[model samples]
Target chain A: MDEARSAVRAARRSDLHALTDLRLHFLGEAAHADARLRLMPDARDRTEHALPVWMGQADRVLLVGLDPAHDPQGPGADNAAPVAYAMGLLGAVPPVLAAQHVGEILEVHVDPAHRGKGLGDALVAILGEALIGRGAQVLRAAVPSTHEFARARLERAGFAPLQLELERSLDAG
Target chain B: MAATFASWLQDPARLVVVAEEGGRMVVGFAAGVVLQGNGWQIPARLGRITDAYVARPRRRLGIARRLAGRLLDLLYEKGVGTVRLAAAVQNEGALAFWQSMGWSDLETVLERAVPVEGRDPEA
Candidate 1:
């Protein structure tokens, strides 16, 4: 608990178990089905299956933050012990286009107890730097209006609203 | 340089389409996915058109329409009762195109920022 450094670094496959837990903690109850289908399966099975693949993908970058104050082990921190995390795609097409290489924020989540900390901001800056270094020209994020905290975080990180999608009732159609 | 888009599609969740002209040129393409339920109780599938492309010479030949229709049919077959897609705020022509195909607006997603760093202003 000597130095409190919110370092943003590449996430390792070993960290998937904890990341999945964090995702479930934040998104499990309220997230739509697609997210659940994508993230919340048998946790161990999915983590084991997806994490290694993710780590191998050059386009994907998983940034994690550790507060030495909380995780005293420094960089050797465990999967169940992340202070915060940000998962992003380096070359992505916004929802409006078919192209590629647009930086995209896939997921950014911090433990509820760590909400007020600047960990989210640090993670974003790290991700941005990594992305720009890898040739990302434009970065985009898709956040629901209901996610006030995430929306605020993205704006603070310098992202602006570029597109708005609407969904009509199937009954109406 | 390697085609980044093709390499990016390795994610199992993505829906992708591509057309190659007998190994000499690119022709047409489209892509989308059915979003069923991430957590909500909504049982219907929501189709999202992520990418649609057709070479200029292949335009006006019903390629895009067929591609879109094929995606829609795939969604229906997959048990998605409804589908949604988005367009840029200024993409009137694209908007018209979706409308022509029976897709419509959904909801507006907004953004706000949390201040970080620098000197705190006087209250």
Candidate 2:
């Protein structure tokens, strides 16, 4: 691969298959770091159905990162497959909290072969901008406690530990 | 606090369970919302424990333990396969209390303040 590009664009309905493929890859990789992320039988079906609707929502965003390095026989590089993706959602905390409005970064994933090329950073930046434009005062993300690499990436972007979530199986409840 | 409880009581998705031990007064409560699991991580429905409290004097009578068990019973019976709750890192007591009930560390929620357009971080 030569001349890596970090260009990104809003996802279109045509990108549904690519988005679903990347989502499963993200889940598969995450399950390695945390045993809880089992891909359900309906994972593919749920995501495919959710993406098109999300892409058009004003408070939600789906972005695709392009890596022209692998665009074959193309002059404009429009056919380059999406090598990275990031989804953002605007939400509000419970009315009890002072910081009511917030933005959440969900399911951030980049192709393994395309790492270390600033593609992930670019995608995060774009999503952050989009979320900010929609009146999000705080940006939030959650990652497996053992996934240090992902945590470090967000930390470098100025994220700090706000809270810790704990869970356990229901038998003892 | 009363209004907050009232709001939760009004919302159909929110479940507010209170414990009254041996008196007409309320002693403690556990509240949560029925939410789907984050992203596509877990296929089953999720119940997020939004608030839990037991009066100081009511501690260690196994009141909290029993209350938590009851809360989980209702959650799981309602189709929630996983339950999660957030607590401040400094709240070691809360952490220990939940740990004693089989809860363990799952995820860390990270946050960043968005820079105001006209403000400078260095300034």
Candidate achieving the largest DockQ: 2
> lDDT per prediction?
0.62, 0.79
In model 1, the runs with Cα more than 4 Å from the true position are A1-5, A29-44, A68-80, A92-100, A168-173, B1-46, B49-78, B90-123
Q: What is the lDDT of residue A24 in candidate 2?
A: 86
Q: Which tens-of-lDDT digit does each residue in B1-123 have in candidate 1? A: 136466547754456666667887768877777665543223435667777778888887777888877766665566666666777757776677777877654433433232332212321
| Per-residue lDDT over B8-40 for candidate 2, one digit per residue giving the tens place of the 0 to 100 score | 889877887888967688898888878866456
Judge candidate 2 at residue B8 and give its lDDT: 81
Going through the candidates in order, what is the number of backbone clashes in each?
18, 0
Q: What is the lDDT of candidate 2?
A: 0.79
Cα-based TM-score, every candidate: 0.59, 0.86
DockQ of candidate model 2: 0.50
Give per-residue CA lDDT, model 2, range A44-106, as digits (tens).
888888888888898888899877465434675666668789999988776676855688997
Error of 2 at A65 (Å): 1.1
After superposition, which runs of candidate 2 have C-alpha atoms over 4 Å from their true positions? A1-6, A68-74, B1-14, B36-39, B57-62, B118-123
lDDT of 1 by residue, A108-141 (tens): 7777777666777777767766665565666677
RMSD of each: 9.6, 3.9
